[model samples]
Target: MIREVQEKDYEIYMELTKEFYESDAVLHPIPESHRKAAWEEVMRSKDYVQAYILEEKEEPVGYGLVSKTFSQEAGGMVIWVEELYIRSAYRGLGLGKQFFSFVEREFSSMVSRLRLEVEPENQRAKELYEKIGYEILDYVQMVKERNAER
Candidate 1:
């Protein structure tokens, strides 16, 4: 079953986030303190940062986080899929697509576009994203780390 995340599910969400990041391509895990702060921000936001939990017999098995962001140039809301993951054992059963479809339907009224980023090395995830109609953004995402000492 899939449902919106509740405050009671915070621990499960944190566990899943940690497990997914540790097992996958995630470069850094959000510190416990930072995670708490970030989740507080999410909960307090007027526009929702919604999370969907997939459960089996009342235990959370997977989750996805979707949020809406308004585009100034486009003048419409964009649905950003911040994270999606299904436990390894539960993959290949179409749950991921179902999760995406749920997000599409839930935000259809507000969203003008759907957006997500996938690591180049994660071919499985890339294939799934493409299969669901997400195209690669042609521009490379460049970042410069600032040093406090500098």
Candidate 2:
């Protein structure tokens, strides 16, 4: 089951996010302070961020984070899925598909498209994303650090 994340779910969010960042799928560790601050911002900005707790039998199994921005190419708002992590043991149970379906149903009317980034080495995740109708773009994605240190 999927439910909107609540203040009481903070511990689970932190634990799952730690596991995700520590996994081989991630390229490097993001600073703990940055993660905490981002989570706090998500909780505070409901209009800009949408997060949900993925549960099984009413217990936390994973979580997802989504944010929106205007896109001229998309002709309006586009949703970016920043994180979607399911417990290693609970993978391959179609939870990822369910999560995508839930999000699409919730935001399809407001956004022109949904986007996410996945590590090239994580073929399993890539396949799941493709099955859910996401396609690889020909252009490369790049990021430029505006601050020398943060």
Candidate 3:
């Protein structure tokens, strides 16, 4: 089952997120305190950043975070999935497909499009995403860090 994230799920979320960051596939590790603070801030803004907990047999198994914004190109709201992670023990069980299915059905009328980023090297995830009908955009993804010193 997929449900909205709650304060009670914080510990589980943190544990899974730490594993996600530490994965050899994704080695960007945020400090524990920083991650906690960021999670708290996101939780406080329900309308902007939506977080959902994925559960099985009433136990939290993973989480998905999405942030919404108006996009001129889409001519309506667009939601970008910032993070989606399932516990290693629970992987390969079609949970990711279920999560996307839920999100699409829940937000179909409200958003014009859904978008997510995947590491180029993570072929397993990329294949799953493609199977789910997400096409790769032609444009390159570029980012400018706002807090970096000029």
- CA lDDT of every candidate: 0.79, 0.87, 0.83
Task: Report backbone clashes per prediction.
Answer: 0, 0, 0
TM-score of 3: 0.90
Task: Give residue 110's error in model 1 in angstroms.
Answer: 0.6
For residues 1-150, what per-residue lDDT tens digits would candidate 3 score against the true structure? Answer: 999878877888788778777885563766777568657867788667877888889988888888888999999999888788988788899889999998899889999999988888999899999999999898897888754432
Off by over 4 Å in 3: 148-150
Q: How far is candidate 3 from the true structure (C-alpha RMSD, Å)?
A: 2.3
Residue-wise C-alpha lDDT for candidate 2, range 1-150, written one tens digit per residue:
998888888888888888888988789877677678768987888777878889888889999988888999989999998889999888888889999999899998898989999999999999999987999988787899764444
Which should have the higher lDDT, number 2 or number 3?
2
lDDT of candidate 3 vs native? 0.83
| Poorly placed runs, candidate 2 (over 4 Å) | 147-150
Q: Using lDDT as the measure, what is the rank order of every candidate, best first? A: 2, 3, 1
CA lDDT, candidate 1, residue 119 = 71
Could you tell me every candidate's TM-score relative to the true structure? 0.86, 0.94, 0.90
Candidate 3 has its poorest 10 consecutive residues by lDDT at 141-150
Candidate 1 off by > 4 Å: 46-48, 143-150
Better of 1 and 2 by TM-score: 2
- Cα lDDT of candidate 2 equals 0.87
Q: What is the lDDT of residue 71 in candidate 1?
A: 85
